[model samples]
Target: MKFEEIDLSPDIMSGLADVNYTELTELQEEVLPAILEGKDALIKAEPGSDKIASFVIPALEMIDDREEQEGASVLVLTPNPDESQQIDELVWAMGYHAQIESASVDMDSDAEEQEEALKSNVQVISGNPGPLADITKKLRYVFRDVKLVVIDAADEMVKLGLQPKLKAILRRVLNDHQTVIYTEEMNEEVKELTKLYFEDAEIIGLEDSSHMLTEPPKVDGMLSHGYIYVPNRMKITTLMAHIEETPTDNCVIFTASKRGTDRLYRTLRKQNLKATSLHGKLSDEKRAQRFANFTNGDVQYLLVADIPAAEIDLQRVTQVINYDVPSNPDEYRYRADLVGSGKASRVVSLVSKQDRSDINELESSLKQAPKELELPEKVKQKLKERKKKKKNKKKSKNKKRHNNGRNKRKKKKKKDELELPRPSFDKLSGGRKGQAKKDQKSGVIGLIKELFS
Candidate 1:
């Protein structure tokens, strides 16, 4: 659809033309009209789908034209600082002609400055959910007139543990508001939110199949999936060996946990490998620096744990290795999709015995299992020795348990043999001489009768 066909304001049209945005993408064509109509919507959009423009343009169009408006009319919730910045810039460029005032709540910036900006009677506001939620609590009037709410990268927000904060901001804006959520697909988290808060929301681009995993993931055809079956203890060795053997222009190694990423990064650095790491613990400045280093060809290897998909650019990545297989099948597809498009890229996974269930899930999602890759000879030797040690440990434990059981049985048998009959013991304990003598006579009679028989 052409922008000229829509009944948008002349100012917005001029802004769009300035940016060379003439025709609407498929996602925009489907979502733009619904948002303009004040209907709640859940849109499924892949990366690079130009999904941001759909909501951002409509959000700009919906701002109350009056200059005396009290609070922000549009609230945009992003997953990270980068996305928030992007929204702020886009809103500025598109809302320029209309003199739309927008404020971004940045966590890394001076709090006083952001607070001061919020007090300027901004028409649009955007920020990460954490800062946004806190801002809403302090400045309750900021969202008092919210006519539209855009949850950009809804899945990423949930992945970053921002769901509660998102809920907090939504709860405060309790008035009749329009909600628009953009995600890769209709995940469980997004589905639950829509059912709970979004009334009869129109879900766009979602397949009728369950979880949208009925078909295989749409990854680059040139990319290959493979795994190296190694023992958990030898995973590090296997990864190092693979790295040494297969050189790449750029590589991304994903660990299952932050501690694992740290350990792997330290090990690689110890070996004098040109490597860096990315994780949730790093400061935003440090993270951005390291990311730039990798993307700018300054670094060859990047070890990451729990990085949002939007943060990583796959264009320069040539190889991807999973140091620890992820439990979620979606993670597998995400890693697979990280390979550069149209390049001979490949994704290798270090699969251990504990990752069997996760591998099965990936297979189900991919419609085929990852091909098995032979382990390096050195790694194989280490794995063999580790298995041998584990086997010996198991045997020792079983032997110790058997010895303990045998000793317990011996003690019980000895105690049983030493025990006396209850009636004889009772007669001997009695203080009456007559009773004792009668008991002795009965005992002697019984013995004499046994001997005669």
Candidate 2:
């Protein structure tokens, strides 16, 4: 359904228009009405479902109608600082302001500075429960004013042991406020928490469906999903050759670790390709900058760890290369679905022998093997040639090092011989008389030699 059909305010409608948002996604269309009605809600949605806006729009609309007041009006609790910042940005982009009470921010900053930076009547807070408790004590006024509480990634929060603090926060705000919880999974713990907080709330489930408002473009249609089994050493070479031949405008390569991401970024850049790396090891500012570059078309390739699966939106990504297959079947499905969104035209995964068990489990869980394609002969040949060249280079470097080591040893021996002490005249003859006579004779001879020269 179109967004205009919803009961949002005119100002919000205008804001949506400015952002070019015309219609609602399935989840949004289903849950937004209940949220607008001020009914507590528990929404089950997966990644890439555009679920952020499902609640963000209604929350901002509600806060907009309330009179300006002290303390935050809306509180969004996210799993990590990254998601917290992302929520803040969305709130501000909708012409509202938000504050992120991330642990990274120093505790001594004045509340006014904190409020000003957030730019809204809303505040996004993320931290461990202990530190969060301390910070909350200092901002009792802020908690007192919060009228609505949101918990994003509810399942992850429970897994991270923040459920107790979350429960306490909900209890603290229960007097006259509404609660909304969103999660990708509906496990028992999540179910229990929702039951406790949203005793009489509405539950909205957005199941994976077969409906699409628009068919993806033909270029995206060309993509064939599949897997290949090879030794681990061959995966990188295979991926490099694939990209070298059919270089797409933009691609995202996912690895399991920060080290892998860095290695891939360096290897691709050494081939004279532009690439950037992202992972938890980087500062938030750097990660945001790299994400901006990738989104703005300044960077054509992004080598990242799995952290981006839930956070990044790559609208023009032409390819997704899974350098390492994920261990969890659900995670594999999530990553595959994330990359296969209309944003990316093709998804390519490189599976190795060691990953066979994981792949088999994923296939069984998903109830199907991904479609498979044989490696094109040209690409296969290119990969073989690259491997051969790399092997030869390694051998040559090893031989050169061996030869240099021998030469270095020989030079060291010669220097040691040259530095050895010569037999002394004083040791060969009677000590004092011989030394004095030699010194006088040597002085006279040296003077005569200098005059003659």
Candidate 3:
């Protein structure tokens, strides 16, 4: 059914058209009506499924005239700051940026910002559960007024680490209000969250998440995997080599540590490679900017750490590089998930000899081995040529330095020539006396020699 058939607000339809959203994706089609009818919803859709707009569109319509209200009537919460900002983008994408007062609440945000986020007039607030829970606990008056709550990326948020906080926030929300959950899998936390918070909630499960190897929506589509073995020393070099050989158009290189991402980003920059990085170490604004640039194709490559792996959408990346093996095996797929929403051809992971076990775990997770990939003979030869050129360059540089040393000795002699005493016109008469003496001596000697002859 078309969006107009669903009786959505005319303004929302206009915004949807502005963003070229002509028809709803399957997930959106399944979930939007339940949400519009003010029913609790449980959504399970894969990455790149346009799931954000499903909730965002209906939420916008439900509260368009609430701009004059004092407190937020609807709330959307995400697991981390990156996802929080992403939700903010979707809200704006739907042309609700002006009509909806939104705020992002994160642990790193200052108290004043957090307090401002609590404004009842701010109808939409997205943020990490910890900070949101803290606000609900401290400022119940503001959050209790919440009428609709959306938990995006529900499976990840339902983990024990974040579950209690999420539960507490849910408990404080007005019981009469609606709770909508979006998830990829029906994990225990998801099951429990639905049981506890959503009574008679509409459940929309796209596919069985248990058969992860075969059942994920885009897995059977145009996607493949490959691996490369780099001696511990040459991991980055091998990665650079792969990038040099392949199309890195909107690629993501996954690094394990914050420092790894920063180091790789800076190293690539020094080599004049155009890329940016994302990790917890950066401010929320910086991470959003880097993600935006990569999404918009303004930058070619993104050096990222693990937190963003499963969270932010990597739109149509043709390549993904695992710069290092992730600590979690699930992260291997998360990295792959970055590229293979459908169009990814290969996800090349760089595995060092010592860390070969990481690949083993990855295979175990996949239940099979990916095609073994070796550095191409041509690329290898090219790298060797590059190496030779680099070595030759260093030799040439040293030769220049060596020649410069000898040139300094020649220069020293020239400097001595420059230091010779010069005649001053001020001493013209005094300098002539010495010259006249020398001439007299020479003339006397010449006369004596001539007489002897």
Candidate 4:
């Protein structure tokens, strides 16, 4: 379907033309018409699909139709600051010709600036749910006139534990407002959201499949999957060797934990590799900047952890290196699918002994095992050194623990020897010193009086 056939406003059409957004994707073709008619919808589509445009274009059309509203006509709640900011930029580009005022209230940005933007005659507001919910609590009027409510990346938002804030924002909005949800897959949380918000809505792309399990993720046929078996201790060294030997231009290295991501990033930087790290600990600005660097080809490598694949739009990613095996089949698929750009790409995993079962599960889902790749000699040498180092460290730790135990025992014995018997209060008070007769029952008071005297 083409944008020209739709009844969008001239301004929105012009903006679409400016961005060359003419043809619609399959998801867009199926959902856009219903959305344009203000029907609530639940849509599940993968990343890099034109999912954002499917909703954004209709939202802009809706706001343009209701241009005279007093406050924001559309409210978009996203999972994180980066995703919110990305949508905000898209809104700016698509809404420019129409002169529709829009603001993004990313969670970690300056509060005063967000408040000031909210104070404007903004027709659209895109934001992270937590901050946006807080803002609406203080500034109740910001979303009073909202006609459209969009939860972008709903699955990820739910995963990030933003459902409470999303519900909070929904409660404040007018009950009659249209609600639309977008996600990479249908899950329990997304279902809960749909049940709570929509009476009966159009559910796209999952009619026959199980609502609980996500469709197996898939990449282009050109992408290849491979793995290198190494122990946990040598994973980093193996990763360094692989990057140095592999002629990859744009690559993303995925780690299962933030600590691993930071550790690898530090190692890469120390080796003077053009690399950056993306994880939850970074501030929004820094995360956005680093991601921009990678996307713009300013950096050749990116180390990422704990970030949902749906949250990021991986454009032209030549290679995806799994520094650690993915925890599940869905994860394996998502990471594999990130390798794209019409050219042949690669998904490489470093599987340790503990990760063998995970690899088997991924193979069961993918119906093919990853081709085993030989580790470089340098990585093998590093493996031996790591084993020896770990052994030495363990010996040192045991020796130190043994010495500490002996020292504690000696100190305890000395403390026991130096101890003296505690005297009873009666004996210390001279109760039986023979100062008073046995029949005299004056007790402690009599002893005190006698001592004073």
Candidate 5:
């Protein structure tokens, strides 16, 4: 359906037309009506489905447009800074009359300044949930008249421990207000919240059995899936070879841990690969700056820790490389969602022998297996030998350690048995103390006689 058919305001339609957005995508067609009617909704739509516009339009339509409204009428909570920034820009595009400001108190900005933004004729407050509780607790007066609250990417916020912030905001938003939750995945916590918060909310994604399982290459705008099976010893070499051979313009390489990012980033940089590291270690400012550099093509590659699902978006990211196979389907889904900008993108996962089963499970969920990309025979043989040698070395060290421990215990036992008892000087004789005094006097008289002789 066209956007105008849905009863959106002229200003909102103008903003939509400015961006050439005329018709609603399937996701919008599904949930926008309920949202616009002020009914609580739990929406599940894939990334890049342009679902934000669906809710943004409704939020704009609900603004009353009367100059008398006060405080933040709508509050939207995202999972990370990148998503917040993306949504903020989207809000500005549509919220032409909104006194929009950030409620991202836990970020780099001054808490007071962001608070000032929240209280200054604020109609919409968009930010992460990390600091929402503090703001809500300190400024309860401002949230009393809120009309709607949106928990965008709710599952991701739960993963990042931002539910406490939501709990804080919900306590003060005034009861019986509208709530809309948008997420790709729903777990027990989300369902529990659904039961606790809403009396009769409509669910969107689970209406059919066919939608339960997502097929790869179609689920999240990913065009192809390919995997290279290599041992740990040959991973770097294989990765470098693949990158050099493939003509991808920009890549986000995911490592399993912060330490892994450090090591991989250094190796890539040493090879003059124009790579930098990103993980939980970097401050918010540095992380933002580095990501901006990568997006602007100043940095060619990002060696990142297994980034949270919502925080891994870039405008022109052509490829996503899993330096190690992801541990769960959520991570695999997150990594796959990176490529939804209408341009085709590739997701390549490096699967070792141990990771084959994990890859199989992920494939099972996607209902599609990954095409195989082979490593060199020489590298495979070297990897086999190195693994065997490493295993033997560990056994030898364990044997030596056990023998040393046994010998130490045996020596301690033998020394204890060979020890003699020491005498006590306080017990002069076996009889009594007076007998020893008389014996001492006799000994002195004998010594005097010998001297006279």
Candidate 6:
């Protein structure tokens, strides 16, 4: 269904049309109406599924009706600073005046200035619970007209030890305004939070099948899902070869750790490849800049950790490589779906014997085996050759060192004999001239010859 069909204000509809978002995504189609009706929603949808719009559009519609007086009409709370920035950008791109109050300790000066400038209108506040709680307290007097409070990624916030602070803020806001909670997983924490805040409110659960369609349009002529088992040492080589073969304009490589992400990024860059790294360690500004570069096609490869769970959107990504298999089945599903969502045609994973048990268990738990692909012969051969050559080179270096040490010891013995002092013949004058002198000279000559030789 088109976004225009929804019962929204003409201004909001025109704004969506201007951005060329003509059709509503499945999640948007399912939840927008219920949200517009002022009912509390507990949505479980992936990122890039138009979930943001489901709430943002309706919230904007709600605010547009009361445009005359504004003092923080809408508040969107996210788990991390990165997602907060991304959501704020989405809010702005919709032609709505908004601000992103970074919850991070090191908020960008420019972003802070912009947020301060636009604090009076509909703005998105993103930060850790500590800073947000502080802001909420201060805004109690400054933004007394705040109406809508949204907790995006509610499940994650609870997992990251932000629950208490979040609870405090919610208690303060629930005194007068409405609350909306959105998450990808409906865990116990999410349930508890929902119960505490939206006790008597409506709950709308968008079924998984309803939100994600079965068949997505193909990018090229191929659509495949598979995994391969390889040793740990060969993971980087395998990924490089895969990217070289696929010939895509852009690709994403998922690593399990921040160090791994940086390592892969450095390795790829040293090979003269265009790549960027994204993880929780980076500053919010750096993360935004890297994401922007990747989306704009300035960077061909993006090495990201699990931080892209909810905010990254790359429609033109042609391939996704899982450098390390995710341990959690749900995480595996989420990452796989992120890249495989019709936009990315190929999803390849590098698994090893060590990873097989976990991978098999995950597959069994999920009840679907990702199509398995045989390791390419050339890649296999190259890996074996690399191992053999490394071993041989180490052996040769050790052997040469041993031989050089033995030769040096022998030369040092010869040099010591040549530098030894000789006794004077005059000291032996008391003995019989010819016999004694001949005996002494013979002894000295023999000792010298043995030592020198």
Task: State the local distance difference test value for candidate 3.
Answer: 0.72
State the lDDT of candidate 4 residue by residue for 382-412, as single tens digits.
Answer: 7778789999999999999999999999999
| lDDT of every model, 2 decimals | 0.78, 0.67, 0.72, 0.80, 0.72, 0.67
Better by TM-score, candidate 5 or 3: 5
RMSD of each: 17.8, 17.4, 16.7, 19.0, 17.7, 16.9
Worst 10 contiguous positions by lDDT, candidate 2: 209-218
**Stronger candidate by TM-score (1 vs 3):** 1
lDDT of 5 at 328: 67
TM-score of 2: 0.40
- How do the predictions measure up, each by TM-score? 0.46, 0.40, 0.43, 0.46, 0.44, 0.41
lDDT of 2 by residue, 1-453 (tens): 998787777777776776677999888888888888888877787754277777778877876666665556667776665555555556666643322222222233354555444343334333334344445555652355666777778898889998877665555553477888888886657767776765666777833211111112222233445676644456667777778766788888889999898888888888988899888778989989998998888888898884735456555467777788777554454455545445336676777878778777766766545655566455577668878999999999999999999999999999999999997766766567686766655777867866887
List where candidate 4 sits over 4 angstroms from the true fold: 209-453
Instruction: Check candidate 6 and list the clashing pairs.
Output: 103-127, 103-128, 229-351
- Give the worst 10-residue stretch by lDDT in candidate 3: 211-220
lDDT winner between 1 and 4, please give it.
4
Model 3 quality (TM-score): 0.43
- Maximum-lDDT candidate: 4
Which structure is stronger by TM-score: 2 or 3? 3
lDDT score, candidate 4, position 204? 78
Candidates ranked by TM-score, best first?
1, 4, 5, 3, 6, 2
| Residue-pair clash count for candidate 1 | 0
With a 3 Å backbone cut-off (N, CA, C), the pairs that clash in candidate 3 are 70-120, 70-121, 71-120, 71-121, 72-120
| lDDT digits (tens) for residues 1-453 of candidate 3 | 667677866777777887788877777888888988888877787655287778878888877745455476678877767767767667666755345656777765776777765763577777788988887678664454676788887788766368788777767665478888888777545666666765566777834323222222223234677688774366677777777777655788878788898888888888788888887667878888888887888878788774646566664677888887775555566566666445436777777886688788767667445567888565577668878999999999999999999999999999999999998745675566766655655877867866887
